[model samples]
Target: MGKATGFLEYERQGGVLVQEKQRIKNYNEFHEYLSEEEQQIQASRCMNCGVPFCQFGMEIMGMASGCPLHNLIPEWNDLIYKGNWELAYNRLKKTNSFPEFTSRVCPALCEAACTCGLNGDSVSVRENEHAIIEKAYKEGFAKVNIPNIKTGKKIAIIGSGPAGLAAADQLNQRGHSVTVFERDDRPGGLLMYGIPNMKLEKDIIYRKIDIMKEEGVEFKLSQNIGKDKKASEILKEFDSVILACGAKNPRDIKAAGRDAKGIYFAVDFLTSSTKALLKVRQKDKKTDNLAKADGFIDSKGKKVIVIGGGDTGNDCVATCIRHGAKSVTQLEMMPKAPEKRAQDNPWPQWPKVCKTDYGQEEAKAVFGSDPRVYQTTVKEFIKNEKGELKAVKCVNLEFSKDEKTGKNLMKEVAGSEKILDCDLLLIAAGFLGSEEYVAKAFGVELDEKTNVSTQKGRYATNVKKVFTAGDMHRGQSLVVWAILEGRECARQVDEYLMGYTNLSPQ
Candidate 1:
């Protein structure tokens, strides 16, 4: 470490954020990075613990703790502390294929179980990581690394999200002739659309896609493998196929009047907004909030009601605010989590706590209050004469444990019903599983949860020479887990193709 006592000497500094009012006006990322020297100081705060729990990927109490990619946290932190930006990037890339994307979108699981965070604030590992990767991109160290030898083995990957992209990067670098099929007009499926641009700008995704193209990965856009092209045809062409389509079957509300107009899935709304922005930016190069809302449903001047209190719900709140919504509200069926970790949640386990994310912050800033209401849910939708959403009837929820079964049962509180005016109702209640179309097209079996069936603890599917990774197999999860699944799945695919492979597991 650059300074042995740096953790004690310096206070933890996270990425600075743009003022909420100002940031809500634009769809750009709000967090600003610290300077080089300040970032070095933040990196120096890494304790370099003998255990280095930050890099320890482990499942505790049904939730993953620490970095799933098992990044070389201590090594990279030391490099950053010493001002060796290139070396830090090198160490980071040893495990992760795309740091730039993860730096922006990931929830910083590494920081939660950090040794420094046991009592005090955690080392700013996430921001330090951003600084490292951004420096790499700016200083020209992140150039295209074309594979020296061509394996001449052809591989087809379906989907172009983080998992698919990571697998393509690894396999292509190993000299495999990899072709990625994306159903969207562009690559980076959810990264391009599901996630709001303010969280992860579209250009950052295109930049990485550009690099992948230069390194010999062919990206076929607007091709739905099972629909536009036949899965059987791809199976005949490629030696092996990997499916990385994310769990995108959104969980929709079935309350009365659900079919009313002015309601949409969170992903659909986000996708439409991004598509409009892309269309406008490409045509006129304007960054202002002006875009064609022809087919896409908009929330401008509409009372918006969002169901679900997760990150996606928060994103909806922020997006609605930016769209000039008259008012906004988010509904959570469950009781609010504790502000601090409970006694049962000890160190090294994922903490269940209340943390206001950027979207919630933006919502609070714009509407003069937080949009989230704990222990509440939409009971039914109210509609107008034209069958459009006019408002929603909500009811307060009370959870009680069963005396004998020990199961938490939800009970609707009597006389606790209220109706809120709403026109745009966006369901942000997470996903069920991968859409059945692609999995069914490949003749692969699905698990009870409707995810692609894979061998226990493995990525191989029921069909021979076919594999599934990411949310498509693992259910809805964070981006970092998708990257890990992709890397490990690629290694297994390489082994299957080359008899014995040289690809490193993440």
Candidate 2:
């Protein structure tokens, strides 16, 4: 440990953000990087316990408790505290290929299981992580990693999200020619579109992609493997294929008037808004009619109703508020978690506490209150004469134990139905599984949950010379988990190609 009494002396200093009033004006990253001194103090707060639960990476109470990537949290934090920038970055990259992505997007599962959090606030593990990677970039240590030799082998990776990108980075470093195919015009997959610009700027992703390209990874954009290009052709061309297409089959809200216009999936809405936002920026166009453009949905001067109270729903709330929506509301099926961790939620398990996120914070600031309506759901959709969504029929829910199964069930209150004005309805209810075409095209089997099937604890699919990873195999998960899956999958692919392999394991 850098300082024995560091945890006692220093309070957690989280990353600061731009004021809501200022940040709401534009779609750009708002989190202000902490200074070197402050970051050091945060890093020094790590207890560096005998067993660092922060990096334990185990399932506790059916939820992720530690860093899924098994990040070397204490090592890097100590390095940061001691000002060993290069060593800290090296240790970080050894376990994670994309700290930049995880630093911004990962829920910081490490922080939740921190030893410090057992009694006091968690050490600023996530913010310190963000600091290390950003500082590495500033110090020019984030350079291209070119292979010293060529293996004369080729790998084709489907989907250019975090998983595919990590696999490509690893395999390319192992002297294999790696090629990533992306269905969208941009290559970062969900990282480029599904997530908003304010949280993770697109340019950061582009810069990383550019570095990968320079390091000999070939990116094929707008190339849908199952449709635009034949899977048979890809199989014939490469020695191996890794599918990381992600779980994109969005769950629908099957309520009354569900087919009404102005109804969109959360990903679709986010993707369209981002695409339009960038297009306007690139064209240097000056207009407030962003949503008025064809195929774009704007929330300006409208009452926006978002279903499902997860990160996606919160993102929708923030986006709508930025769009100048007259008012915004979010509906969650489950009751709100307590302000503090419940007794059942012991240490090392994900707290499941009611913590306000950036989006909710912004919504609270702008709308004068939190927009989340807990234990609520949309019962039906109210449509106008033109078949456009105008309002949502909502109802309150109560959790009760089933008499037969002893399981908790959501029982709708008999007289709690109410109608709320809604100009646009975005389904943020999460995803079911991966889309069907690619799996069917490649003849890969899917599990009961609709995810690509692989042997228990393995990344290789039943199909010969094919593999699956990330959300495609594990269902929807954190960015850190995706990176872990990709890295492990690459190792498996490498071992299959050569009789053995030399890849790092977390």
User: Per-residue CA lDDT of candidate 2, range 280-328, in tens?
Assistant: 7776645434654566777789888889898888889888888898998
**Model 1 CA deviation exceeding 4 Å by range:** 291-293, 403-405
- Per-model TM-score, in order, reads 0.98, 0.97
Query: Any residue pairs clashing in model 2, and if so which?
Result: none
Candidate 1 pairs with clashing backbones: none
Tens-digit per-residue lDDT, 308-328, candidate 1: 899888888888888888998
Predicted structure 2: lDDT:
0.90
Q: Lowest summed-lDDT stretch of 10 residues in model 2?
A: 285-294
RMSD values, in order shown: 1.1, 1.5
Off by over 4 Å in 2: 285-294
